[model samples]
Target: MSAGSHTNEIPRHRVLAKVEGPLKPGYETILTPDALLFLADLERRFGRARRNMLEYRQDRQERFDYGELPDFLPETAHIRNAMWEVAPIPPALRDRRVEITGPVDRKMMINALNSGAKMFMADFEDANSPSWANIIEGQINMYDFARDQLSYTDTARGKDYKLNDEIATMLVRPRGWHLEEAHITVDGRPMSASLCDFGLHIFHNGKILAEKGIGPFYYLPKLESHKEARLWNDVFNFAQTFIG
Candidate 1:
């Protein structure tokens, strides 16, 4: 016998239920088909929040912001201005135009920068062991050079630009996904051998730079097309939103 009705028949109605997680950190909502049905139930029981979801989104992002991410993503906004001179990278700078190799020292770089060559490439591919230490060192060395003393800097960059100056553009062709025999040794022993995606490194580092109110420098090489540029832009945008 039924409790509500003294009949063997059942009523034709949809059964619904809602479940909430225990109040704690790291609780994620399971949004299965069943979970959606439960959401409908919750709408019936507790009702929805008054604020429009989009309005709350930005606020939520702000709350989630650790203030560690950069404030602006870097992008080359080509605006034709009379005061500033515009020059496309020399044709020689394009992929396959210049050959690069070996562990480079500051003197060699200074020579390249001083040379009147339209393009100078610092190769991470053939040159030097691409261990993390080397990468960091290369970056520091690349970044520390006095641009004003360098030809590219004197012409494109201001005369005052010095080593460690946040001005001037430099091109670095980082070692690709080629694994070497000698792995990047960290802490003492060799930690691991792997490919370093310099593209990603440049993107994140560029943002780190931009967040510090500095302009990023670097000519991207071996690009297939606009895709790499778009990736760069996206990384920059993401970096800008958080790097504070």
Candidate 2:
């Protein structure tokens, strides 16, 4: 085999057992117990499924994979650091893959982490009371988990973290610059509900992640074209230099 090539088949692990949750209104149950058993047997004929992160690493190396993306910034790979103080990500993300879900602030975050997802963005900007205090508190709760996994420190903005036991693939979505009105109160009171999962996870290189030396955020909606992406990247890069 040539370098970076392997012919051996990797071991497979079945998710195994039956797990069920409630069906939402109007949705039909597609598989019965007998059907599930049959499907398992049918899968046995093929093989177990093993996830391989290296597959993704290989694609990234070959320039064969990326998110819904476009052209990259100059010296994109030559990036000195993730440089949240400089920028979180570039237009490269438009060419890479992006996954979206609500900010998991409560212990529900623990469930999402255990479910095998690769990344989590605890949402303060768009998932909690839009009050600055609430946003800061929710972020603290997330750092409760972060502190166990990595060494992080930033007391100025009241952000510090360390990590342990699956620190969680995570990012954070701040209130979208355009959509803060979606949750921010007019009288400056906390929102009756809270921010929904609508904003992108934009980090201005807070004292938390700056302590850890890692940075990235999921670009949320309103990003309609590459020019817009370039603009967002520039904004993040500029913001992170001081905050990050």
Which portions of model 2 miss their true places by more than 4 Å?
1-100, 124-134, 143-146, 149-164, 181-216
Question: What tens-digit string does per-residue lDDT give for candidate 2 at 1-244?
Answer: 7899876653332222132333333112222333233223322321111112223334544664444444566766656456546445434233224344455454455555454445555665545556534544354445444344324455687764433354345556645433432222222222211122211112212445445643444434433334445544554454444233
lDDT of 1 at 18: 23
Q: How many backbone collisions does model 2 have?
A: 27
Predict model 1's lDDT versus the native.
0.39
Q: Could you tell me the lDDT of residue 135 within candidate 2?
A: 45
| Top model number, lDDT | 2
Judge candidate 2 against the unseen true structure and give its global Cα lDDT, from 0 to 1. Answer: 0.39
Q: Least accurate stretch of 10 residues (summed lDDT) in model 2?
A: 192-201
